[model samples]
Target: MSAKTNKGGAQAPLLGSKIKLHIEKLAIGGAGVARHEGVVVFVPQAAPNEEVLVEVSLVKKNYMEATLLEVLKPSPARREPPCPVASVCGGCNWQHITEIEQRKQKEQLVLETLKKFNPTLQFEYLPLKESPRSFRYRNRIQPKFKNNHFGFFARNSHDIVEITDCLITEEALTTKFSEVKIWAQGKNSKDLQRLEMYISEEGSVRYGLITDEDDGIGFSQVNRFQNEDLVQTALTWAGEDDYPHVLDLYAGAGNFTFPFAHKFKNAEITGVELNPKLVEKAKSKIKEKRMKYFLSDVESYMRRAVIGPEDLVVLDPPRAGASEYIMRALAAARPKRIIYISCHPVSLARDLNWIFAWSQKLGTPMKLARVQAFEMFPQTDHVETIAELRVDS
Candidate 1:
């Protein structure tokens, strides 16, 4: 069977099928995996060791997709979801699981992904960092506006849900949501598509218009509490410097670079971002002595420019992982230290594989010094990870 099939055209496996299968693990997108007759079925909202009765949504040659219908037996890690709209809204995935259990699950996923890529790799399970505030911690949120209502879209569907308050966003944003909703209700303008809320490091709130041409949604971290933890953790790993030359790749609006400049007064910090408007904003915010901002993709800058060995590179790439070209260029540059912050652990593992591969080709392998996970999105399956690698001297 092909992966693509018209919905309702084919009758999927029935919901009451007494398939007593043990869930072995979780897929990257938070689906539970269970094998039956050598066929793997992906079930959402399921946990390891769960026995569920699911209705197959799609059947492919190798695997099947299912929506959980009945939980015959629940896993010990499972917990009641706090948000009423958790299952309906696609914003969060692991809300049904306990916070500590969620962290463990994410950590396991990271380790499993790494092991899959590098069979010989072995590392200690670093304790996952808990967010200072689990709920209402997000500093930035992109709420979609559609169907004459303002709210987040249902998971995997375009149907907009009317949300009274988002449990994960800061109280201020949730409080301001009513105003936006009222404005959207009255206005019939087609110009506004989505609203992005940004709360800066100094606790300043700003709103941005997400448009087709540009995303000034800038580099502000999503989870406010975790963002602080991540920044401090990254800076600590960056180490004390007399005057270290810092290269911030994919640096959106100087989120890290601006604050980092104050810590290292004599350091030369260069921030590179793709958005011109954000770059301009970052430049304006620069009152420090040794900081520069550039509006260019990291790959283009690395391929054409000359980098010194004394420089330290900080990369916070998108979820799709860093481009191969950029990875190769960074390997060639051989910076003293590379602090990589990623939202998607799977992509981070993939990019780390490339970095390690390229470094080995250069005859100087980089050491994976530290790996830290942050609960940026509580009540969800998503996790933010930061990995630090140093060039083996």
Candidate 2:
């Protein structure tokens, strides 16, 4: 295969070249990172401290991507993946590595990424929180169905990887796989069938095709067991401050909103979510006059939000993370406490940088009190982090 540089319009001679590498560590995206000829090479399914043979696939100006040819020397954490389709499936990437190693790598990844973005930033780094169940913990999944195939997309490709069951998914959802396939067969469409299967809030398995008009049930924590602990951690970190107001930004179906309402009964709890369905779900459960749910994007809400020095803000933004304007607004508002729940570390680190930069500029400094990484999605590189921030008074 011919390799081409992503920039500079130059031909990459390393394309299709075979080389031996000692993987030093895993990168942010779960790729084993190694340096070859002074350029970083990223190989998927590689374990740290392992000697491996790889074939270079894509070459960029400063780095190259490779396919793992063979593991010459494997790390002790390396193990056989529990899933039969793990080799081809795109769902869980770190199944080849032991769970302990996965947690260790994840903890290191979060700390290193944060420090990389904010060099002098210091806060209490808590130990990684373990998931209640490493396997069978995923409560929701979006599987693809096409040409009688039912499974997830192939690694870096749109092609489907057929699988009878997913190891990372809970039994409640996995047991309905056959039934979902039968239901998909009734669709009778030749185009690639995109489907969503999840254990609903009612504890029943639900499945359906994803259409352009709708994005399915929307964002909710996939690991039910881990979510309980995550919610408690956020509440605990936020503390029992007698703030007059509480804000749950990016609130979905009142996951944290209702809990915050219960914890701070006197505080007026407000939730802002763009999805009308989630907003409706949240509003329907409102029991007190102090609770309010709005259907608006967080950036717009932050623009009009009346934040004060003693208010607590709990924001669980999506993977893309919150915007700069919102971060600047929060820094200016200088809430007494802010609990940020992030699923992506790079974005989280970037957002924190924004907050600190704005805080310094506005002369209302905010300090990171403590941060903890949660193993929300085990057998995958995805991690959930909760951070507490306080006004530097």
Candidate 3:
């Protein structure tokens, strides 16, 4: 099924004859899930249980992409998005969806991913942790400059969209946008590649200009309000039992390590990171303590890591997930408990499968103790998840 172009001259390829469909669920990427003529059609900005009139935008062999032309029936969980450019900005995917609904959806996604990866594993979904402040929670934002104005590119597109205020950014940052814009215009603004802003939990604001001259923008948590909460939650999971040794992998600027040091005063905490600049900064921030900072690839550190039964490990890997060599090292260490924090569910699932396989081979199984998802980025398809695994005695 295809539709003829109207006066607008926008050529949209229709994939199905059915114009109206009831969305049954949400795809992993935050698109509305529906079937037209037995083919899956994904419509953006359409929530689950919503009856929408979709315009077929792109058609593929197995699935179709669509634009929500009209919402015949809105879901009860829908809310008015705060950001004017929320729809255009690719940073957020669930802005229109209510916060409660967003949490629920993320929880479901985590559980489903775990089930797919480990079929025999049984664990209860932990209560979703809510960020103390949802809106204006982001401490760091890297807005790009284009055409002599400060703005951010649409998700997956280089085309810039000028932004006056960002809903996810701190109020102080949003208010200072004009100041930053003016500063950029005066300097060799064209030479400026990216603007990175960081607002601490105490409301301290710092900005970094990514350019050819200086490459050091210390590692900082993107979401301000959630950062503290996430740190506290992780510390709780890394209990202060007989285990006095803690390993913090991917420890950027000591965000987790700095706080963990204070939380577990008697424990020996080590942070391993690849960035030398970050390691130096982390060392400066964490003073007069048993904390150790190493500048090396996480996999390399893990390979040389020797852990005893009284140690607990925390792995906060990037979107690519932990490497296979690191996974094997973790298996060898056999920590009493391991905390895995990930931004990509697919990679998390893959690593979990590898861990499960290793445990099965060793005949000492590791069980998923608990799993929870946090909505760090609203109005986008991205999710931040944390999973706890304990080795069965």
Candidate 4:
């Protein structure tokens, strides 16, 4: 355990030092935030408004990380996590906090993050859409197996936490844990094995070890129960206008492309995806000539995209969000309506800032019409948000 002194010659807390603190709130990553002697301390698995004793793990110049030793006073929202390995497994972070509180914190986190990035940003902040089932909603998961230990990795460590069941996962997959373990055992390897398990589109559980040739099922919404609402919300927000052109950026297996196609029968629908597996799957299901799926990176396709003022663009980028070039390109295109779906608040706000800035410089400002957060992955710190943008009148 090493400790360093600040430039002012003040000694910082050494590793393994015990600190009693009152948690004010949860940070973006599900860590309870508290200040000790003017230095911010982050304690994982600690609930907000709770008094807890923590042991310092790492000390930095302005902040410190600690492990929760004991909760002297638990928050009213705190509850026993349903999963047996909740404390050790890194799967669900908010299992200890009440589901209601989890949604509240996520909503607040998104709102605060957006406002923090752009203060003057204003839009209709709708209430957070709650998941129908907080637990048993996940249809896909990646579990690790090694040395007969079959489960997920521990928090911040590669050590596996064996589990007979996962609370947040759908029963369709949980019932096959024993079979998965047996399959993993037959691998006859000593190295840690990475596996992917999910219910296929045909409604059967599929499990296998990941390999270079077999990447398993590509990206898809894990929470199908709530994904319905997410898709519907995106479609409704897109409005009734039959735009001349419709583009679905980062379109994973035509989650939005198919829906948009059905809504706008005459409009030309284009889906740009980089993943060949996902593109192939999306293309296999398309039966209309007006619908096209292109296997190309979104940034590259955007460079050649010919968007019009009557075009509608729906982009659901990965967690890293879209690049500045894509944002600027969309701004310059001046699409009539843009639906930006983001899984991270910080990136969403930052991307929105770029789009609005570029629009202003181009003398075609974009307006954020409305925003809503979705509880797609309940019992986790992750959140999905959808924003409607239109050329400012």
List residue ranges in candidate 4 displaced over 4 A. Answer: 1-5, 9-11
Ranking by lDDT: 4, 2, 3, 1
Q: Over the stretch 188-234, how does candidate 3's per-residue lDDT look in tens digits?
A: 74453588777754777777688667664756677766766777778
User: How far is 252's C-alpha from truth in model 3 (Å)?
Assistant: 0.9
Q: How many Å off is the CA of 368 in candidate 4?
A: 1.1
Residue 35, candidate 4: C-alpha displacement in angstroms? 2.0
- For each candidate, what is the lDDT? 0.78, 0.91, 0.79, 0.92
- Model 2, 213-301: lDDT tens digits are 97899888899899999998888987878999999999999899988899998999999999998998888889899998999999989
Better of 3 and 4 by TM-score: 4
Over 42-117, each residue of candidate 1 has an lDDT whose tens digit, in order, gives: 8888887777877777766677778788888898877777888888888888788788777787778777777788
Which of 2 and 4 is ahead in lDDT? Answer: 4
List RMSD in Å for every model shown.
Answer: 4.1, 2.4, 4.5, 2.1
Q: List the residue pairs that clash in candidate 2.
A: none
TM-score of each: 0.89, 0.96, 0.89, 0.96
lDDT of 4 by residue, 213-296 (tens): 988878999999889999999999988997999999999999999999999888999999999999999999999999999999
